[model samples]
Target: MGPGRIAGVVTVPELAEGDRLTVDGVDLRVRVSARRRRFALTIEPDATVTLHVPDGRPAPDAEEFVRAHRTWLVTKRAIRERTRPVNPAKRLVEGEVFRYLGRTYRLTVADDVPSAGRVRLVAGRLVMSRRAAADPARGREALVDWYSRVGYAWSVGRLQPWAARMSAAEPALEVRDLGGRWGTYEPGTGDRGVGLMCLGWPLFQLPMRLVDYVIAHELAHVRIPGHRGDFWRLLRRALPEYVACRAELDELGRRLWMGEIWWGG
Candidate 1:
C-alpha cells in the first residue's frame, strides 16, 4: 500500500463530474470520486473524497467541484498525518506506550518465576518477567508463544458456545491456525468432525466485537458454505453491527501484520 501525504491545495475549475482527485499522504491515501451535481467526503480507516451528479452530467467537472471543498482537504490531510503508523519495534521496550481496550499502557518488564511469561492486564498494560533469552530464536519463540496462547484462550472461551448455538451440524469444536483468512469453518469430513482455524495472534489487536463478527461469519459458512444472501442474513442476525466491526478489523490488519519480526540472528 502507498503512503498517504498531504496534497497542498488542488483547485481545478474545468472538472465536471465522475472524476477522482486523490491526495496521498505519508500515512493515508485520500481520494475524491466526483460527479456533476453533488459531493461527499469519506473519511475513516481509508479516506475517500466523493461527488455525485445527474446521469447525463459530464464526468470531468470534479476539478471545479473540489475547489469548494478545500477546507475539508486541508483538515483531512492533517488527520492523516496524525494517524500515521507507529513503529512497533519501538513499542517492545520499557516505558513505550501501546493501546489495548481503548486505553494506553506503559511497558513494565520484571522477573516472576511462577507466572513468568509476558502478560497484559485488562487495562492493556504489559507485564514481562525475567526469563531466559539465550538467542534471538528464543526471543521470537517467547513472543509468539505469549501472543498465541492469549489469543487462543480468549478466542476459544468466547467462540465455543456461540459455535454450538449457531451450528447443529457438529458435536465438538476445534481451533487451529488459519492463514490468509481470519477464520474458516469446515463441516464434518471424517473422524475429524467440525473445526475452526483462526489466524495467529490477530485477536490481540482486534476488538472483541470484530473477533465475534469473524467467528459468526465463518460459522455461518458451516451451514451456507458460500457467499449468498442466506449467509449474509445469518451473519447479520449474529452480528447486527458486523459492518463497523469489519471496518475496525481491516484497519487493525493493515497495522499489525505490516511489519517484520526478528527473533534472532
Candidate 2:
C-alpha cells in the first residue's frame, strides 16, 4: 500500500507499493496492484526492473518470482543495453533539421514578428521566431507544443479506422509528453464513460506506419488491459505485420529528437 525499501532476501508478510529489493544483484521496485491476478515482471524504459505483484502477496513470493525469471531478466536487460537511445541534442539554428512523419524539415529562424514565438511548417521548413530560437527553453517548448497540436490532429483522423478493426470504441485522445512511454490507454470511468488514450508528443516524429502500430497497440489495450498473450493475439489478428512494425519502432525511436538542445559556441 505504501513505499518501502527491502535489501537482500528477507521474508516479510506482505509487499507494499514502491517497496524495493535486490535479487540476484538486480534491483527491483515492487508495485502491488489489485488488478493483477499473478506476479509479472516488467523491464521499464529506463532499464529499471519492476515486480508487479498482486495485492496481499508475500515478499518471499515476489523474490521467488524474480528468481524464476532470472534468465528473462538478464536477456531483456541485455537487449535494452544494445538498443538504448542515442538521440542527439538539437540546436535552434539556421538549416537545423527536424522530422515529422518520417520527413525531414530544416529549421529557419525568422525575424521577431508578431507571430515569431510560434513554430510552423512553411514550405517544407520548420520556421520559428527569432525570439523563441534565441532561448533554448522557449524554443523547446514551442517545438513540443507544435508537436502536441499537430500530433493530436493527425491521430484524431487515424483513431476510428483502427478502432473499427479492433472492435474497440474510439476514446478521448490527447498528445503530450509521456516521459519514457510512447502511448498509454486508461479505461473509462464513471464520470468519463469513454476510455482515454494519450500518445507522447515525441512519437509524432516516426513514420505513419509506426504511428499506426502504436495506435493499434493502445486500442488493443481497451479490450485487453495487459500485455499478456491474449492482448498480443488480439493485436496480431488486427495487424498481422505488427511484429515488424514493433521492431522498426524500437529501432527508429532511438534516433528521434527528444527536445534536448545544444547551443554551440
Candidate 3:
C-alpha cells in the first residue's frame, strides 16, 4: 500500500500509456476493463483488486493509478471483512435466534393463544399458539400482528411526548402500509392523515432508540412538511444522536419493510 490511498482499491479510468505507479507493502491484482466512461474506484469484499479504463485511455496510466492507491485499498479490505451480513432466515424457525431493540430473542411457536394470536419475549423467544391448520403465511401474519400492536402502542406512548413538545396541535395519527418507509405524514387529516406503516417483525430487532428516531422524524414532518435545517434541528432536540438512528433505520428498511397489511385510510 502507498501513502495517499483512501480505499483499499482505487480505480483510474482515464490513463494514457507510459504511466506507471508502485506500492510499498501491499499485494494487489490489477485487471483492465475495455469499457470505461469515467474514473471510479471500487474495493472488493476480500481486498481483491481490479482496475478499469475507457477505450481511449492507455493501460499504463490505469496501472499507475492502481499503484498510487494501494494503501487505501488495503484499509478498505479490512473494514469489509469485519462487517458481516445478518441472515434473515434465522427468524423463520422456532427457538432460533433473532434480534430486537439491539437484543437477542429466540423464536417460540405457541399454538394455544386462547384467542388466536402470538407473542414474543425479550429473551425467552416467540410464543406462537395458533391452530394446527395455520401455514407459514398465516403464521407470519399472526406474528406480524403481534409486532404491529406492540410497535403502535410503544410509538404512541413514547413518541407522542416529542410531538407534544412542539406546542402545536397534535396531528391526527393514522395507521397504514407505507411499503419501505416506516411512517409518513400529510398536511391534511381527512384521507391524507399521517400514515404509520406497520413495523412488522424486523423493526422489533432494532434498538428502541432507532424506533423513537423514526417516529419522531415522521411526526415532525407533520408540522414542518419538508426536510429543512429546522426540521433536523427539531429532530436533534428530540433525539440528540438521530444520525445514528437514521443509519439503523436505513439498514432495517433495506432488509425489512415488506409491503403487507396496508392499513391507511
Best candidate (score: TM-score): 2
Candidates' lDDT values, in order?
0.53, 0.90, 0.55
Poorest lDDT segment (10 consecutive residues) of candidate 3: 256-265
- TM-score ranking from best candidate downward: 2, 3, 1
lDDT of 2 by residue, 46-150 (tens): 678889899998877788989999999999988888888888899999999999998888999989545766789888998999999999999999999999999
What is the C-alpha lDDT profile of model 3 across 29-93, one tens digit per residue?
Answer: 44333434543455542344444445566445555666677677767767645642333332344
The TM-score values for the models, in the order shown, are 0.54, 0.90, 0.54
Candidate 2: pairs in clash:
116-129
Which ranges of candidate 1 are over 4 A from the true structure? 1-87, 97-105, 112-124, 130-136, 168-180, 257-259, 262-265
Best by lDDT: 2
Better of 2 and 3 by lDDT: 2
lDDT per residue, candidate 1, 141-169, as tens digits? 45556656766677667666666777534
